[model samples]
Target: MGGQDRESDAWVYVVNSGVLLDDAFASLTLKRKLERGRVSPENLPPSIVGRVAKADGPTVEAALEAAAAAAPVWGAYPLETRLDKVGELLCRRLTERAEEITRILVAEGHPVVLARWQVSGMLECFGPESLGFYRSQMHQEFRHGERRIQVRRCPDGVVCVNPPQNAPLSSALLGVTSIMAGNALVVRAPRSAPLGVMYVLHEVVRPVLEEVGAPPGTLNVVCGDPVPLLSAWVESPHVDDIMYFGSSENGVRFQERCLTAGKKPILELAGNDVVVVWKDADPELAAEALTESFYGSGQLCMIPNQVVVHPDIADALIASLVRQVGHIRPGRPEEEDVLLTPVLRNEKFFGCLRDALDKGAELACGGHAMQADESRDTAGIFLEPTVVVVRGLEGARDIDAVRHETFFPLLPLIVAERAPDEVLLERFVAYVNSNEYGLRNSVWATSSTVVDTFLSQVRSGGLLKINDSHIGFLPYLPTHGGTGLTGGVFGEANYPILRTSHLQGVSISPGSRPREAVFGAWNALLPTKVPTAFPTTFPTKRSQEF
Candidate 1:
């Protein structure tokens, strides 16, 4: 492999007619500059990059043609082969380039720690334990003597992936698992942050694909405006399914379009996740978990958007949270341990705060916007990790912060009204369950009964975190996806390998007679003789059951 700088390499990847197409399709010059080891406001790759992309919106049709030609061949390969190639070989390559990938991610405005966290999450998803679990779920069989019944997940031919701009690299990593599900994939990398993702694909993943003897056009990577690229996928007969990530409002509308075009839509949309703190909860642990709301300046869809605290512990919990918020100051992305990114919607942050304050709410700490170096300023790019205390649940959802998914570092803590344990617990769980959007919900509780109650009743989101890190990734747990607006009609805990595939049942029966098999369920009730021994010929009319 040539040692070309990935940030400046040909960003678009296309192959057609069994031949590679590496020519420049779109010259995306999303250039930035590093000032004193810190990423500047420009974001994305550094100044060395000339053009950012190679593929144009219209050129995506060639990707579809290439993917279609490769789907059957790629899907027919054994699942184990696919897993070994991606889960092992590709995993190794990524590990070798972990430092590089993290640098690129950090340069693209992801904080250093968050960049590493993203890379680690991708690795864990491809780890043996997780891959093994996926293998187990991919197929299951039950045998009855020589006859067998099998339930299995099969790849849905060609799949298209549209990763979100906020987390392009990680989403691209997940999208590649379509190959593990035996699909040929076309990845439409987010134009806002395509370089790092395209770099990983070309440098790490494509090499592994070649090593595994995968056919040409098995995976296509392109970059352009999502509107046209998505339309291209929706209109194409060669495309089978689309795994899309975007805001819930736009995504649900796009889901309708995909359906109208007779294509399956797999959505990863916005999350209005909740965190509940009961009286029996640990304040320190709850504060730490709640800090996830400020990660990536709270633009991340999976992080907690609002909090619900029992009135018994609201004061103490709010104090602890305020102290913790003091430590979450804004800084440049490449700075050590910085979590905040430059938020574009400072007005929305203030708007939510103002609405909350107008409607009987109080700001505990960190409400105003700040600059990259953490100074208070009106026109600063970063919104301080702000926490608003909303007293009581009555009419709380009417507030925009409580009802909607605010893509800022503003957290609304609903202080439950004073009540008995039974009433408070019941209402709190009901509130979380009734949220319009659900990706994740976390609870910090020490009492066994309280924990069990919340777990049993709050059943809307995809994943439930009990006294654990809400944003942390676990080996087998789904790291992305949820129900309601977070995922369209077919949304649940997303394992991309399974999401891009469809379930099918296979049955095998040998040497079975048609008429005998028909009445096999009632064989014991039949007179010990054969049907031929039924006196003379059977009645002219057959039984209604038959």
Candidate 2:
């Protein structure tokens, strides 16, 4: 809150140094471009998203210089010391500032409950259990007979993190795990929702960094368009890695740039996740799982964007889903009872709906655009929870409603009614595997054989769930990142501590003698007579069987 004026909704830069800039050259004024509700688009409110100091050439140069100067020293610290100091500090600060952070998120149009959940999730991610889990990956060794081999994890110089606008704080925290492995960081808070993330970094993390005597550039925060800084990073030789979260197209192109510049890129791209319901799955549970499509108004990457159900159970599942979704009503973000809020992409959403309807897809429920309830101060931007039914993947493959990622409260159901059970299963598996996005996928099935087959056959999603909640966070598990359109060539379950670090193998012996020399006799074979030159003579007798 350094440069923030509540009356004008103006906020100052929240940098690692905790100093506010007064000069125009050092600051960038960011106005609220998109807001909740569909009222008065022309006369936008005077809310300031943020007024941050730009990370220009000179500023970024100094930051990279400091980080480069601090890398060796920070990396040399004992792993346990870094873990104890940084992990405990993060947990304490997040808990102490939970209410303040949650309020900021809610004010930014996040449902009150969802905001609380996000805050709590961030806290939990930095908790003791998560720390311990990551610590376990630092340095591991195993003894074999008379020798011991060790696998040591080391930081990859400097990492630049670019968090997405949708979940800035959570994304930044994910990158913070790099510190546990002793890597220096430069984090970019999302411009649209920078306050919560920026506040946490400045108010909570910065003080602790000073207390622990962390190097000046061990952590840096910037708020502005990432394009220029990304270009700078691509050209900078000091930067070693990048943690990027963005659209599939942009992420793929950025990854290419990183590769060209000889830098490592960890990507978390767009997701069009799916939930497959087999004929034998529990109808009630399947319906409940499908409800996740509307959670956070279907804005999350992990939520199921489409449902593929066996025709035998399609009617029952659809009925259950319709009933469950009917209970969800869009309410004001600040209200405690609110379950959903308005998203700003009105044109894209309406276009997708129109395309779906025109393509012969039937709207099962909640088809019309939501009308604002002026009495309740609700903006008409909120989309009614909608369910569209398609015959199968082919029916919607060419339609935007299914092909592209629709980050709104729209769920499309694909009924695979093609043929015999085996053919249906095979086609369904093929469809899921062929999907470009690979964030997460869920399957509802009672048969162990069916579950096993799906898991073995489908090589699409990063995290596959069997009869469990699709979006639930598992701290110990690698729940972030995906494959294909989700994450590019180097895609894997994202564990920042591991992804930001590299593994080195260490071998130990009791003696100083070279292994080759010590085992020379055992490893070598000699003939009766040594032939210095190539010999033409050879024996052609049958050899004895061993």
lDDT of 2 by residue, 162-276 (tens): 9887788888988888877888888876756677777777788778767787777777776656788788777998899999998899999999999999999999988999889
What TM-score do all the candidates reach, one by one?
0.88, 0.83
Candidate 2 local lDDT, residue 168: 83
lDDT of each: 0.80, 0.75
List ranges where model 1 is wrong by over 4 Å.
Answer: 1-46, 521-546
Q: Best TM-score goes to which candidate?
A: 1
Model 2 — which ten-residue stretch has the worst lDDT? 15-24
Candidate 1 lDDT tens digits, 262-337: 8989999999999999888888889988988999899889998999998888888898998988778667666777
Query: What are the clashing pairs of model 2?
Result: none
Q: Which predicted model would earn the best lDDT? A: 1
Q: Which ten residues in a row have the lowest lDDT in candidate 1?
A: 15-24
With candidate 1 superimposed using the best TM-score fit, by how many Å does residue 451's alpha carbon deviate from the native? 1.9
